[model samples]
Target: MTETLSIGERVAWYRRRRGVPQEVLAGLVGRTADWLSKVENGRIELDRLSVIKSLADALDVQLGDLLAEPSLLDWTPDTLGGTVPKLREALMDYQQMSPLLASDSTSRPPDLEILRTEVGSTWSAYQDARYARATRLTPGILAVAQHAVRAYEGEQQREAQALLAMAYQGAAMVLTKIGEADLAWMAADRGLAAAQESGNLVVTGSLFRSVAHCLLANGRPTAARDLVVASVGYLENDLADASPTYLSIYGTLFLVGAMAAARIEDRAMVNQFLAEAEQTAQRLGHDANHMWTAFGPTNVAIHRISTAMELGDVQIAVDQGPRVDTSTLPLERRVRHTLELARAYSAQNRTDEALALVLDAEELAPEQVRHHFISRHLVTVWVRQRHGKPSHLLVGVAQRLRVIG
Candidate 1:
């Protein structure tokens, strides 16, 4: 019944149902009554997931309740609302918490090779932007990874733990993409614990990226930045003979740090981090997807555009976004950067170009486009602000995104 209403309408309804005063609710989320009023009246758009989560907390409702994402026709089965519970169940399985429960005399020994291959497959699907397929694959991979970690002994056990850590890292990333930031944090924490058990510095550093991403998703950018900085410091002493794996992990940390700094509008730190990342990329000397980090000169350039966008230098992003060729990158990276460029176009009132880019991105990865908040919000604003007749292209995209019936 609530699905038909806009987010603001739902907020207003929930606020009234709870008998909460506007001022009180507003104060709870650190906003003024006037701000809340604008939100409820749909005069302001709630683009930030952090703000939406805060309102949900203040209203004593689930985040999904406030989001009220209309189920898209093509993607409903694997929607965030539909898929997160299964992943949550897998992550929360009691057997993983107590490995002894998973051990049995009749059970077959876990096949380490199969488990490793499945983990790699999961990440490959994810990098291809097949989020639903990746999401579906994660629970099984995690279950097998946990079993492998329990079944193996000595060095094999450590190897299994590293694989488990990578599986959890993949899970955390998928959760973040689906807007389950809290769950993502839990997955990252689990990954970090597994990484420590493996005693692998590279795995630990990579898992740090997952944790930082969760922090950024949860709107704790300062904490995210600090975490990345510390992680980099931990790896600082080993750079003398750093492998491509180390360079990728080290450089990607700086990229994530740049993003975190950008969120807080820390101009100096943003520049510092970006410069550090670029230097690391140059040392690597070419585009490579080492450790699935996608750390290279091209990737660094992509982050520069992203940081610029985050810092509200829309002109810089607008100027630099189009020239960068992401053709050699993973499908996920390519599509994401495309959406970022679309957002810049929309911000500059180049609606036609923005719409075209969105269309192009949707063709490349329909699931990603449907699930991304930026695309959804952009379509919503375009629909709301339009006059007598909307563009058919816009209407088609909106319908596919479930922004309108």
Candidate 2:
């Protein structure tokens, strides 16, 4: 019944249904009645997730109840919609819950090498920004990893646990990117559990990165930052003789911490985290993708741009964003950096450059820009703020993203 209405109209319907007056609802959400009226009348776009959530809380309703569009396929691919449920089912399967109950002939002596190859291939697809493909492959890999953990014992069991951790980490990464925040957290938590069972500190640190990302996706940046800090402290003494994988994961934690701090406007922590990450990058002495982290000197520089934006230092982001060369990075990293820079350009009202960058990102990965919150929000803003007939380029992008009819 609400499918045909704009988000504002939906809000209005809920407001009326709950018998909340405009002024009373507005006050509850810390807004004026006039503002609420504008929102309800579709005179304003509710773009911020935080504000949307606040409104939901005030109305005593689930967030999805207000956002229950008939389909996300206008922006999200069918691949995502189809695969997420499969991934969830795989994660919640009985085999993942207990190894004792999973002992059957079909699970006996599974090929570890084949499982490792499948896990690695899924991560590679994720790094390349083939998100839908990666998601499609996750369920099978997760199922195999679970079976391996169930079948093996002693040292082989530990090895199987490591594989399970990596598989869960990959699933978490894809889920986070596609805005499946709750499922992402579950995947990360499961990965962390597997990593601990494997008794691999490096893998544990890497899983901390995934957990921190889930925290950030769920708007708990402070918790994310603290987790990163604690994980780094736990791993700090090992860096003296750390392998490239250890260094990469260690440095990447600081980067994630910096981003988390930036979200809360914690300038001191942000600076401290960036400095630590940069020093680690210098120690490593080059760009590297150790353990699929894509962490090193170049990545540290990219984080600086990301943190600057998060801290609302838009000019700094604008100034330094274009200087980094991301060609050596994975396609996902490269496209992500491009989107951040485009966001900065839009903030500075350099609309042409922002649109061009958005187009460039689309050319590189059509699914990414369409599904990304940044590109979708920026395009929506551009379409709304335009005075006259919008440009064909802008219209085309918006249409593909389903920001407009």
Each candidate's number of clashing pairs is 0, 0
* lDDT for residue 247 in candidate 2, whole number 0-100: 90
Return the TM-score for each candidate structure.
0.87, 0.86
lDDT digits (tens) for residues 1-405 of candidate 1: 333356777889999999999999999988999999998887776654556767887998866667654233243454444466678899899876577676543567678888888899888878887777777778878888887777779999999999999999999887777667788889999999999999999999999999999897766788999999999999989999999999999999999999888877789999999899999999999999988988899999999988887777789999999999999999889998999998888878898999999999999988888878778777877787688889899999998887788
**lDDT score of model 1?**
0.84
**Candidate 1: segments with Cα more than 4 A from true spot:** 1-82
Kindly report which residue pairs in candidate 1 clash with one another. none
Residue 80 displacement in candidate 1 (angstroms)? 16
lDDT of 2 by residue, 1-405 (tens): 333355566688899999999999999988999999998876676644456666877888755455542124231353655666677888788855676666563746679999999999989988877777788889988877887877789999899999999999999998877777788899999999999999999899999999999897776778999999899999999988998889999999999999888877789999999999999988888999988999998899999998887766789988888999999998988999999999898887899999999999999987677667778767877887789999999999988877787
Residue 346, candidate 1: C-alpha displacement in angstroms? 0.7
Q: What do the candidate models score in CA lDDT, each in turn?
A: 0.84, 0.83
The local lDDT score (0 to 100) that residue 332 gets in candidate 1 is 88
